[model samples]
Target: MERTGGETLLSLTIMSEYSETSSTETFSTFTGLGATSGKLIKRVGTVVVNGVDAILIRRRLNQLEATLGVWSYSTTDSEYVKSLYNDLLELSRPVYKPPIRLRALRLIMGRIEMMRFEDLATAVANWPISYSYGLLKTMILCFRDTLPLIDMSVGIERTEALVAYHYTGSHRAQKPEHCAAFLSWLGLTTSLSTPVFSRVLLQLDILSFVTEIYPTDDHLLRPSAIRFPRQRLLNALLIGLEPVNDAVLINQVHRIRTIFVWARFLNPPI
Candidate 1:
């Protein structure tokens, strides 16, 4: 039977709609499996893609850097930062080539440059610290064979300071093993400058003090603790050690030393 012209057009429209929807879903599913995989496959599928892998990786890395930088500097949008970091996990998937992995490492390091340690510590305090650490460790391991390709001192310093700050703010018992491992890593790297070492040491001391006060069961910094005068003393210990060469700092250091001696004698341990 010959179909009417109107009926034939209607059938064609319906088929077109179905085809469009199906194609959209198929593409979405392919990408949803993993951005890394989808991107790599697309590049490999073409003979003239022209460094498509580097292009895509660089784009994602730039985005990740900007997202984290804004999150750090803005001091808001913890949820948004959390989602972005979560989404970025796609790049770390195992299927990517070594060069791709290397780019991922470089991106990770790039992102670290924008980190505000205090802000990030508070932002992810309640979330699992292991997730952040694991991602960092993965990037570090990926670049292990090509260590000469990147300068890791900056990243390592930032990671140590961040880990120390995060643990201190977390109000949990300081993990000695974790601290030791960080120290070991630092030793393996080029020696940190005096100021950097001093700052990290102070952070570690703060971590120890925090653990002592709150112990393992408590996970929140109490207002009473913050208001305590000892906290000020601890703050003085850290901030006063900055490499500023000023008479005020000299006096402040002298003052802190004097106060420490008197406090030690006056508040002798029971």
Candidate 2:
């Protein structure tokens, strides 16, 4: 989540465009332009998806309309819009290296109170497992606040929050494969009926893999896109390993051999 200190200037500037004109009315409402005005919006053009541009310029334009608008600086709408813009701005940075449309999708979600992620959901279905991993990570983080609503009780908030941290990172070599695979692995094999923790425990295998490979400097652990990001991978390991037993860690590493094998994460990407 974005801690405060977001870019207030730009947010203020954008909102000022729709600010009041020193009028006597305490509030001002702009009826918005005609549908033809859609032509005036700028396209975000060609967000990288799997080394190929996702060609989402059109949808990007639509998002700009819904999320960004002129508003008076001191009005109720303006403050809310400003806050939404700041969050969208946070999601826009390339530090995460996510696909542009994916980021925009999150930004749009951050602004709206209730919505479904239909557009990105469709785009990710055909994506490679690696790309899907990235998209999933962003969704989890953007919606991390909503975990309580989904839970029958709020007791496992910490545990649910941890799953959202699993899928995002810089390199395939360094990325953690904790979300989809872990969820699937537990769903199929577990007979315990309630495997919420199992959902998280399945990821311990990957947790152990990184611990083994990062220290050994081995070439057998490279995933094509799995190059590591310092903050992301480090923190993920820190969280995942907090509950680990040294002996259990050894067995866990052995369990996720297939993920590492398929990822071929050991080979360095040239």
Clashing residue pairs, backbone N/CA/C < 3 A, model 1: none
lDDT of 1 at 129: 37
Candidate 1, residues 1-270: lDDT per residue as tens digits?
123222212334334533454355454322222244234333332122224334544555565655553434343566545544443444433334434444344433334332333323233223333333444344233222233334475454333334323432321323432232222232222122233333433333433333343333222223333323333433444454554644444454455445544654665544
- Candidate 2, residue 126: Cα displacement in angstroms equals 2.2
Candidate 1: 10-residue stretch with minimal lDDT = 184-193
Q: Deviation in angstroms for 4 in model 2? A: 33
| lDDT, residue 15, candidate 1 | 44
Candidate 1 TM-score versus the reference: 0.28
Q: Best by TM-score, which number?
A: 1
Q: Which candidate achieves the best lDDT against the true structure?
A: 1
lDDT of 1 at 122: 32
| lDDT tens readout by residue for model 2, 28-67 | 2322322211211212112222211122223333444464
Every model's TM-score: 0.28, 0.22
RMSD (Å) per prediction: 19.1, 17.9
